[model samples]
Target chain A: MVSITEGKPLEHTLEQLSTTREVTILSCNTCAHYCGTGGRLAMDHLAFHLNNNGVTVVGKELVTKVCIQEQLRGCNHTKTIVLMACSSGLISAKEAWPDAVIVPTNSTLGIGSYDPDTGSATLLFPFPGHETSRGARFPSLNTEAIR
Target chain B: MIMTLRRLDYHALIAFLPRDARVLVWSCNTCARLCNGFGGKEATKALCSMLAEDGLEIVGGEVLSVSCFKSVIRKRLDRADLRMMAEKATHLIPLTCRTGVEMMRNELPWLEIVEVGETVGLGYLSESRGAVLTNSIVEMLDLPDEGIPLSEVAEDLGLFLGPFER
Candidate 1:
């Protein structure tokens, strides 16, 4: 289990990257993948949505572990990075390319365990202010639409 | 870092196992290790010795870098030698966070896993103060701006700190 995160509503994410051009989607395939927020599928869905909305997606980089600085080395420095990872991975991306604008698509809820048997991740340990969300089980984010 | 506190003491832990239990100890060597030797190679070795001295059948003890990851733990347990030892064991003592324990349960469904650690929350290592829990999931705890020290949390909650002491 890793950092448990939730995807922000697609509208919110789009609004955050509204003015940016030549956007690069940086997705974490580990924790965010398990959370159903920032994997290959999530990145592609977001990219498709952004493209249809007239936002140009220049490139897409899928990292196995985005929290590690070395994983971000291969990502090209773009004008705007639509990062589909947790807060930690976002920080790593920021540190990797300080000049580029980083836009996060998810909120780091806290740390939790993913039960493959149940196919849902339980929020066992939420972050400081998110204490009320303990023991909450989250299913995969709906990707049928950009809403 | 993932902060954890001891769920049971040595005596309580011993009571959980039967008299003829063939125990296998599996520990996580990452976050739990950084949480002041709660679970690591050193703790695994110490627990094995202690359990052996107490007359338990210590089939084997192993420590993985990150027990939470399926690939890392599956590879270790799939090894011929470890598999043989695991087959002989009836119970497993997991010295890891809840996620790691879930991974163990998924991997080894036959063996009964005796959980002995409770995951408190996420924390970071401080230069001056050691492991300080910045964010806690324990709703009862009211944290300060700088967060509370893990040692204080452990003591306040009537939980044991570090490795299990006999």
Candidate 2:
């Protein structure tokens, strides 16, 4: 998975969303923080980027999780709602505000592992066809196999 | 300082070490913590333990806010303390980002420095209700793939610790 900065993709996503006047950037602190990505930092950086682009970012919120029902209430706005979390977050945000344009800032990558030596999360690329061998190999596998 | 977003080069830094030498573990608490690197207090302790197990003598370990930000203070107030610590160590293993490493290099021209983490600004990937799913794209979309190797993590830790020193 390509790990590009939100700043690199901000202009493109904004253009695609066709955000003219005001925009609302919403970030989920829970997921992004755990992932080693910018949960709060992304919101601040994006706000700065939008303001510099001559677009007025009306609202910015960094909730525990944007997918949750409680935080979905105040997210509804007439302007485009940009989600700085993952693709799943974008889907949930879109579900809440059907009318508002939901744009995703993060490219969905597979499960990643934190590298202790480098102090960065390394994307754990799933090996294709490894799942098929598991079911076919053993007759009666353990509960772990099913999961 | 040049602000370039790149992962830490642990291998390169390790290669610079001479066989098995005494080293001091230094961590940055601010930027490194923000980047999810080895600048945090917990990470500094872990690094010291890991290094000690690897047959390297750890003289001491310290967690500074920003070595560069306090370069003047580090040079003046902390100079005697640093000099005393430097005398006991063979090298300064900076468990900080590249910027911190660079700052230390410039400030202490005679001191040997090594960096342990990347300088990239951690970016957001995903979110889940109970679990904070940062980088799980496949499971998030429910696509079938060999999921995360939860079983291997224990084995990896065992390997990291080395054969039980009996």
Candidate whose DockQ is highest: 1
Interface RMSD of 2: 12.3
DockQ of every candidate:
0.17, 0.04
After superposing candidate 1 on the true structure, give the runs of residues whose Cα lies further than 4 Å from its correct spot: A68-75, A91-100, A117-119, A124-138, A144-147, B1-22, B29-57, B63-91, B102-116, B123-134, B140-166
State each model's C-alpha RMSD to the native: 5.4, 14.8
Model 1 lDDT tens row, B24-136? 99999877887788899999999999998989999999999888877778789789999988899999998999888988899999999999988887655554566666566
Q: What tens digits encode model 2's per-residue C-alpha lDDT throughout A21-90?
A: 7777787775454443446765777777777778788888777655343466655454577676644455
lDDT tens digits by residue: candidate 1, A105-142: 88888998765555577787678677898887764455
TM-scores of the candidates are 0.65, 0.41
